[model samples]
Structures are given as C-alpha cells and as structure tokens.
Target chain A: MVHALGEIHRVLASGGVLIDLRPLCDRWSIEVFSARETRHTGHITDLPPGLEDDTAANRAMHQAEINGWFIREKEAFFPLHYVWDTASDMEKWIDEEWVDFVGLDEETRRATRSTWALGDADSRVRVKVKMLLTRYRAIK
Target chain B: MSARKDPEGNETKHLHQFADFAGKRVLEIGCGEGRLTWRYASASALTVGLDPDKNALRVARIDRPSDLADKVHFINSHAETIPFHKETFDIALLAWSL
Candidate 1:
C-alpha cells in the first residue's frame, strides 16, 4: 500500500490531489435487523462488539505511513448503505460484490442469515457501512 | 446538491470541489467498465481509463459513447505501472479504485 501511494505521488503533477475513500477498519457504527418474528432493531453505537483495538491501530499506522509521502488535506466519515430486495440479492452481493466477506462455514452462514433475515423472501434488507474519506496532495 | 440524500453520490461532489479537470488531461486507474469515465470525459480534453481487467476493458470499449469517442480512451493496465509519461496528466482520478 505504501509503495502504491508512492507511485501515485510520483505520477501526479505538481499540486495534484489524491482522494481516497476507504472502509474504516474500526468496528461498525450501525447494525439494523428486521424480521417478521421480531420488531425492527437499529443498533447504533460508537463501536460494535468483538472488534479488536488493533484494527484501528493498524489503520492509523497506514494513514501515518501515507502522510510520510503525501500531505493530508482533509478527512471525514460517511455512511454507505446497501439495500437488497431479497435474501438472494443479499447472498449474491456477499458472494460476488464482497468477495472478502464470503467463504464462511455453513454454521456461520446460517447465523448471518438469521441475523439479517427479513419479513419475507421479497422483503427489503439494508446494511449500513461506514467509510473513511481522506484527501491528500502529492508532495512535489 | 442535496447532501442528505444519496450520500454515496455526494462523495463525487466533494471530489469535484477538490479537483476540477475542465480542459485538462485525466487518467483514471482501475476504471472498471468506465463507470465514471462517461461522467467526466466531456469536461476533459483527454481522459484515459486504465484497468488490468481485460474483460472490463472490453465492455468499456464496446460501450464507449460515439460523442466521447475522441475524448475518452480505455487502456488495459495496472495502477502500479501506469502506461503514461511522468506528469502526463493534469489530474489522476482513482474514484473508488483503491
């Protein structure tokens, strides 16, 4: 990643800017679950359970490393939501769009399905993902 | 311009505030299927969309708009090794590439 940043810096013209929008490695900020059996629940918090502190630490390390070559201009956070019309849509997204999130064991998959199950097969499901946005200038 | 709605699309508004490519040369890395090339190509003098995925590039080429045929070009290449001279482009957009 550092090398790629360096290459980008090298390729940019003087004073050229680099906009980076990446997922925050920290714990998710929100989780919403809705089902026919249970009432809709929207869990919004500063951090989610089972998230290790090391994830944020690693992200900071990466940002600092990039700052060594590029000048930090701005940073912000935003929520990106994905809405699936059906369970199959969600499954396909997890399998295709999000390759890294796939390949879980059957038990884990079942647990995830239960967690995100909707009112019916055609019901809507939404997942809110938090992202970090940073703008940097290539140091000439 | 309503930031409250379509927050993901609002990111582009922020990016535009930081960089404007009117009449400038632009290079986009990992430009999958030229999803964004059509958006900014009209404002740029030359826009090169590069990606390592041949299949995506093939689709991009086939979908190239006739009006943008002269302004937009697609290249099959990786971001690590951009096939262009140093300082060749006035702007380099990664736009969700990273």
Candidate 2:
C-alpha cells in the first residue's frame, strides 16, 4: 500500500491533488426500511483481513505525509448506503461481492427479514457504510 | 438483484467540493465497474480508470457514456505500478481501492 502511495505521488503533477476516499474500518450499520418506516438491525464488523488492510492503509498515508510526498488536507465523513429491493437480493449481492470481508450472521439475517416482512413491496434493505474522504496535495 | 447506491448524491457533491474535475487529467484507481467514474468523468478532460479486475474493466468499457468515448478509458492494472510517466496526471483518486 505504501508503494502504491509513492507511485501515486510519482505520477501526479506538481500541485496536483490525490484523493483518498474509502470506507472506515468499522461496523456497518444495517437497516431495513420501507416508504413509511425503518428498522435498524445489528451492525456487521469487518473481517480480520479487511480490518488489517485498512489499518495499513492509514499507516501508508501517514508515511507518505512524513516523507513529504504529499501534504495532508481536509477530510470529512459521509454515509454511503447500498439499497436492495429485498433481503434475499441484498444477501445474494453481499455473498457474491463482500463475502470475504463481511458476513450476514444468522441473527442479523433474521432481524432483517422480520423487519422487511412488516412492509409491503416498498420494503428495502440497506447497508450504511461510513466513508472517509480526504485529499492530499502533491509536493513539487 | 438490482442495487441502488448513494441515492442522495452526497459522494458526487462532496467530490465536487474537494476537487474540481473540470478540464483536468484524472486517474481513478480501483474504479470498480466505473460505477463512480461516470459521476465525474463527464467534467474531466481525460480519465484513466485503473483496476486489476478484468471483468469489471470490461463492464466499465461497455457501460461508458457514448459522448465520453474519447474522454474516458479503462485499464487493467494495479495501483502499485501506474503505467505512466512522472507528472502525468493532475489528479489521482483512490476510491476504496487502497
């Protein structure tokens, strides 16, 4: 990851900007909602590898700043929500894409399905992820 | 299953505030399927989206806007080794791929 950061610095023009945007290594708050109401299921924590990688990413960025490759700047947090029409659809998508990083435990699955059953066709499943968006200015 | 992401456009709005994509050369790393590339690629002079996932790159190429044929490109590569000379891009965006 540090090598990637250095390569980013190498390829950027003087005074150019490097945007570091990613999800924080924390619990993902899962929610089931419909047109009229919403319910919050328990959060899902990231797997060991995902947690380790994000921690390393932070260290790499700090090293980049200390090396004077880029100057750290403003950063803010935002919620990035992924919504699916049904709980099963959400399960399938996550199983396919994020299975290695996150898992839908039996308890959470039950909660999601229960909350979803309360609504009509309007019910939707959501995974709300906290994202960290920050920028760095390349050093000349 | 169909999935809708970021319905509020918060990511786009924040991106616009943080970096002006207008007429700039942009490098987007880990640009999975270009789902986020289209958000700002329209405003950029040139965009090169790099990712190691060939399937995702193929999808990105197929789904790219017709008008951006010349402005946007997808590459199968790794972020550790950007395939370009020094000082090649005005902005490098690492979105969830670091």
Please report the candidate that would top TM-score against the real structure. 2
| Residue-level error in angstroms, candidate 1, position A98 | 1.8
TM for every model, in the order presented, reads: 0.70, 0.94
Q: In model 2, what is the error at residue A107, expressed in angstroms? A: 1.9
TM-scores of the candidates, chain A only: 0.58, 0.93
Estimate every model's Cα lDDT from 0 to 1: 0.62, 0.90
Candidate 1 lDDT by residue in tens digits, A71-130:
777777776656655434555665565544222235434544565564454445444556
After aligning candidate 2 to the native by TM-score, how far in Å is the CA of A22 from where it should be? 1.1
Worst 10 residues of 2 chain B by lDDT: B1-10
Best by lDDT: 2
Residue runs of model 1 more than 4 Å from their true location after superposition: A25-68, A102-123, B1-8
Top candidate, metric DockQ: 2
State, as a TM-score between 0 and 1, how close model 1 is to the true structure.
0.70
User: Residue A44 in model 1: shift from native, Å?
Assistant: 14
